[model samples]
Target: MLSSYLTLAAILFCIGLYGTLAKRNAIIVLLSLELMLNAVNLNLIAFSKYGAIPSLTGQLFSIFTITVAAAEAAIAVAILIALFRARGTVLVDAFNRMRR
Candidate 1:
């Protein structure tokens, strides 16, 4: 069961990686990042439940990760909005070629 959980998490993370790499839209990339983060949280929580620890360290770490992820998302969204305003498109290639 633990193995299965870990496998699922790995699959989710991989899917997120592909999404992040294959998508050109800023919002889609952001969503993929969130998906990857959730995969990590799942692994942490699962380890916390199954592993022999004096305290719920994995759970605590997962909480910390979640907090950090929220901050990252906020910053990323702001940057995306700025990019959209300046470049008129969120596609990675468009942003890359942008110049005066």
Candidate 2:
């Protein structure tokens, strides 16, 4: 059961990695980042449940990670919105040159 959870997380992380690297849209990149973070959370929960010295530490860490990821997403969305207003595009490549 733990192995299955790990395998699923690995697959999710890999897909997220590919999306982050290969996608051009800023929104898609942000979603991909969220996916990767979720994979890490899965691992944390799995270990917390299955480890020899099973405890709540991993779950607590996962909660903290989720909180941080939420903040990151909010800030990132605000920045993306501002950038879109200024540049009229959300392509990752378009954000390379931020100066006029």
Candidate 3:
């Protein structure tokens, strides 16, 4: 069951990665980011539940990751909104001017 959970997490992570890479919309990318974060949380929770309980490190890491993901989502959404306002479009290709 633990291995299954990890496998599922890996599949979800890959799907999210593909979505983030293949989509042109920033909102979709944000959603994909959330999905990837969820996959990590799943892995953390699984390991915490099945591998170790006395230390609680996995759980702590999960909580920390959750906190960071929330903050990242807020910042990313705000930046996406700003980009939309400035460009009037959320297409990834259109944001190429951001490239170094």
| Per-model TM-score on C-alpha atoms | 0.92, 0.94, 0.90
Off by over 4 Å in 3: 52-54
lDDT of 1 by residue, 14-76 (tens): 999999999988899999999999999999998888766635898899999999999999999
Top candidate when judged by lDDT against the true structure? 2
TM-score of 1: 0.92
Candidate 1 C-alpha error for residue 65, in Å: 0.3
Candidates in order have lDDT scores of 0.90, 0.97, 0.91
Model 3 weakest 10-residue run by lDDT: 48-57
Which residue pairs does candidate 1 place in steric collision? Answer: none
Clashing pairs in 3: none
Residue range 1-100, candidate 2, lDDT tens digits: 8999999999999999999999999999999999999999999999999977789999999999999999999999999999999999999899878475
Quote the lDDT for 69 in model 1: 100
For candidate 1, which ten residues in a row score worst on lDDT? 91-100
Over 4 Å off, model 2:
98-100
